[model samples]
Target: MEMIYLDNAATTPVLDEVVEAVADCLRNYFGNPSSLHRLGIRSEKLIKEAADSVGAVLHVDADEIIFTSGGTEANNMAILGTALARQRTGRHLITTAIEHPSVLRVFDHLKSQSFEVTYLPVDKSGLISPDRLEKEIRPDTTLVSIMHVNNEIGSIQPIEQLGRIIKSINPNTVFHVDAIQSFGKLGLYPKKWGIDLLSLSGHKIHAPKGIGALYVKKGVRLQPILFGGGQQRGYRSGTENIAGIAGLGAASKFIRRELETKSAYLYDLKNRLVAGLKDALPQAVINGSLESGAPHIVNIGFPGMKGEVLLHALEDEGVFVSTGSACSSRDRTVSHVLKAVGVDDRIAGGSIRVSTSYLTTMDEIDAFISILASVVSRVEKYSRR
Candidate 1:
């Protein structure tokens, strides 16, 4: 059977144009960017052009962006780098409880090192309160990291307001945002919003895997995470992934060209899926705020049914989906995100994440609704049996 893929929060299928761009680089731009010869210069120029494309989408200067292996590395570079560099200023760091493992794990490591961390809690809708943040921020807070969109529940944090609040309370406190899930889908202006660091993943935006970038606002100090030949101005030292960089730039350019319309297209598909699911399955419970959440993701729960069972049954029908963040899905432990949102064990066990992308179609949404309703009915009845 033909497949209907909906797990966009995990990753996206690379765009055709991006594939060609990467292939073109691999075929011709094989010189190391660090070499001083003409071949190296040509490779370096491609890297620069890619940075220019990504920078334009972010409203940042080309120099402010540094490429990384992927979002995980970018998050580490921003959180750990900023924390260690600014430790002299203050050792206090703050982040939300529902952040991705990349951010949370680094904080865990910090905790082991005796650095104080404050984990902000979210509401039932998986959103943090501005007043709560205003109260939690302190004069000694060195860095605050938050993700713009939750990969599982799709809740969008009020990043601009939060940034302003952090700066107002402590002008010197650095703000870092993990924009991995929101980069291509949402309109973001980090410079205007007072964000000191922002992370991006190419694979999430139809670019190749193993490539990402970090937006380091001018004058923010971060210690070097990777020690090497001092590429990327010593911030991240390594030879540039020339082909991956070219693919990333191509993806950014394509996404930015018609982002408004593309965003609308995603929202339209999301609304249909949500409305259709609710109409078909009243027992269905949505885990995130439908009105203000990210347009590309939704988490639906069916009481007494198992999320893994739902996942496998849907796969049997050639409709692909996931239970939660792919990074942590294999652990068999309960979802930390659902736990943070106060979900009961039964509902949380049955929740399945449904995420869309710019390339997702209306017909796919319609078909998923029909297939999902059928699967849920069978699964619940089988559980009763």
Candidate 2:
């Protein structure tokens, strides 16, 4: 049985080119980016070139991009750093209830410090109201953090509009976006979108894990999160992960060249799976707004089935998907995103998230859907017994 990997929202497999780039860096450019030797200069140059590659994708200045471990750290640095830097100016912040844990938990930590945080509720579509967000922003509101694409339900937030709302309401209030899931699959223009800080993860776009970046608009001051060797202009300190950075750069360039084509292909695959599932299981309910969701992700719920049972059943057929964000898959917590979008706890329990990548195939989608129908049938039979 050929394995069909559809849980891309959790993580994507690294591309062969990315793997070679990382290996090449590890073998040939194995110098510390902070060292003063000639090899170090080459490694440092590699870092700069990689930054430029990622920067081009965001349409931002290369100097504004700061490398970090991954999306979580990028989100942490943006939220915590901005709140700390602007605390004297304001102790109030705003975010959505459906943000990835990285952004939500950071706000929770700040709340413990007496910062007032207002969480915007999503409609059935898993989207925050711009008017509500604008009303939350005040002269003293320090920052607003939102994710571009939801990791669970695949809802695409109106990030550009929300960014405009935050800036228009209070120019001093910084806007941070966790674009980890949307970076390579969608168009992200920080400057045009009025985004002050945008977080990205390399692994989401076929680059290696353990490397990501934060785009801090020039003149936006954020307190340093890491203290070491005074690297990354004192924003994030530590010896740079040279190999990972090289892989990220390689992935960014490749994605940039293929983005338009890749996006169309993903949409084709997603639509095929959705259509197939509906035809096979008429009672299957999609969790998010089909009109506004990302092209690479889809969430479906079986009215009378448990998600885990269906998930494991699919696994037996060489197909893989997830119950929710891989970061919190095993927590046994109610799906916060589904709850926010008004999914009953029982139906939410039956929800599965199927995410695709550029490499996913139409044939794989068809096979998974056929396998899923069979699995659901067998599970239903056992349940009726």
Candidate 3:
């Protein structure tokens, strides 16, 4: 049986076009971008062109994009760099309780160094209220970091509204957004959204792993986390991953060209999957605010079954899904995102996230639903025994 992959949120398969781009770069553009020779110039041109492509997709200047080793590094650089740079101005930061470990861990690290952090709570729908945020703003608050979309639950955050609130309260406070899950899936215009720093991952959108970009609005002040040759405008150092960067560019271009069509297709797929699951298992509950989420993901909870048992049983039947974000899968802890959204411990532990991509097919989704229904039925039966 062919395995049906429903874990696009963890990482997507590199598209054929992106793979070809990377392979071509590896074959022909191996020279160090820093060298002053013809080979180096060729490599440098490719890197710059890649940056330009990604920047064009987001409607930003190429100079504003700094390449990093995927979203984690970009998040670290954005939060840490901004916090450290603005330390003299203020030492207070604000973020949500449902942020990815990358952002949360960076704030944790800052807390260790004497910076004060306020982790704002989310509502039952996994949303942070702008009014609550307004209440949390302090004279000393220097930065507000939030994710554009919740990774596990697929709930869309009110980024533009939140940005306006933050700007109104503290114009000097940098507003950074982790758009790793939303960049390609949603319409993301950092300038229009009033975002000072934005983090995006290539791997999340069919680009090769190990390449991502951080969009630093032109006037934003950020301290360098890495030191070496003055690459990435001296913000991020070391030699650029020419091939991976090229692939990222290609991936961004692909998404720009197909975003609308793919988004609609994904919406249809999600609706079909959710409807099928609901019809087949009435006890199953769809979590999160469906109307306010990205159309490509569905988080569902089976009332009497462990999510891990269902996950492995589906895997055994050639269906692949996730209990939560791949980065936190090893911990076996209930999803922090679900808990933040007020899901009871019993239901939260039984929640599984099924995320789709533009490449996922309806047939595969149906197959997954068939297998999942059977798996949940078996688990429910076993529970009685």
Candidate 4:
């Protein structure tokens, strides 16, 4: 059976161009960026070029970008680093109920350190109300962290609106957006959006898995969480991954050039899959809004069947989806996103997330939908037994 992978939200396959770029870097640019010698200068130049690629796409100053291992580190750097740096300003912070574990867990850690945290709840459609957020902001609020796109349900939050509200309420408050799942798929201007910091992962945009970046607005103060030789202008200290950085830069350029075309293509595929699943399983309830959610992702709950059962059944036919975020899939827990949007545990447990990539084809969608329909039917039969 031909495999149809529809879990791009978890991670995407590296493009051939990205692979070549990485190989070239590994083969030739092996010097540490921290050195002042010619080889080291070449590596540092490569890092600068990569930062330029990402910065150009985001319309920000290249110097403001800091390279890290991936989204988790970027997020940790933005959240923990900012809180620690600005804790003297205030110890109160705000975030949403549906952020990725990286952001949420960091907030949890902050709470232990005596930082007051307010987790704003989302509506049934997984949207945070700007008005509600305005009410939550306090005089002491120092940091506001929210995700641009939800990894689980693919819900697009009103990040710009939230940023405006947070900034208007407190100019000193640092606004951070976790754009791991949205950066390449959506056009984001951190400066224009009033975002003080934005996190991005290369793997989500078909780059190598180990590289990601954080956009720190010029003049924003962040204490370095990782102590080392003070690389990345003393923001993130480490020996840079030259190959991964090269791949990230190549991927950023590719995605920036292809974003509009790729997004429309994936949106069309998502619609076809959703329509087919509905036609085959009328009992299936989509977990989030069809019109407002990200075009590549659709979450559907087969009312009487467990999502895990349907997931493996589809995998048996070489069609892959997910119960939710791949990070939490193995935990066998109900999706917190669905629950935040008021989905019952039963339906949340039965929901599967089908996320397409720029590389997914219409034929793959058709085959996956056909297999999914069959799997849901069979699982429902077994549930009735």
**Each candidate's lDDT (Cα)?**
0.92, 0.90, 0.90, 0.88
**Residue 116 accuracy (lDDT) in model 3:** 97
TM value for model 1: 0.98
Candidate 1 C-alpha RMSD relative to the actual structure: 1.0
> In candidate 1, residue 324 scores what lDDT?
72
Worst 10 residues of 3 by lDDT: 257-266
**lDDT (tens digit, per residue) of candidate 1 on 267-375:** 8998899889878888899987898799999999888889999999999999999997777999888899999999888999888999998777888888899999999
TM-score of each: 0.98, 0.98, 0.98, 0.98
Name the TM-score of candidate 3.
0.98
Residue-wise C-alpha lDDT for candidate 4, range 1-385, written one tens digit per residue: 4699888988899999999999999999989998899999999999999999999889997898999999999999999998999887889999999999889999999999999999999988889889888998888888999998899888898777777888888989999999998888888988878999999999989998889999999999999999989999999888988899999999999988877556577678877887787777788898878877998888888665688888888888888888877878888767778889998887888888888888888888887777877777777778788
Stretch of 10 with least lDDT, candidate 4: 258-267
Residue 360 lDDT (model 4): 88
lDDT of 2 by residue, 1-385 (tens): 4799999989899999999999999989988888899989999999999999999999888899999999999999999999999999999998899999889899999999999999999999998898888888889999998899999988999888887888888999999999998999888999999999999999898998899999999999999989888999999989998898999999999889878556587778878987898799898999988889998889898886899998999998889999967779998887889989999877889889999988888888888878888899999999999
Model 4: residue 158 alpha-carbon error in angstroms: 1.2
Task: State the displacement of the C-alpha of residue 341, model 1, in Å, after optimal TM-score superposition.
Answer: 0.7
Cα RMSD to the true fold for all candidates: 1.0, 0.9, 1.1, 1.2
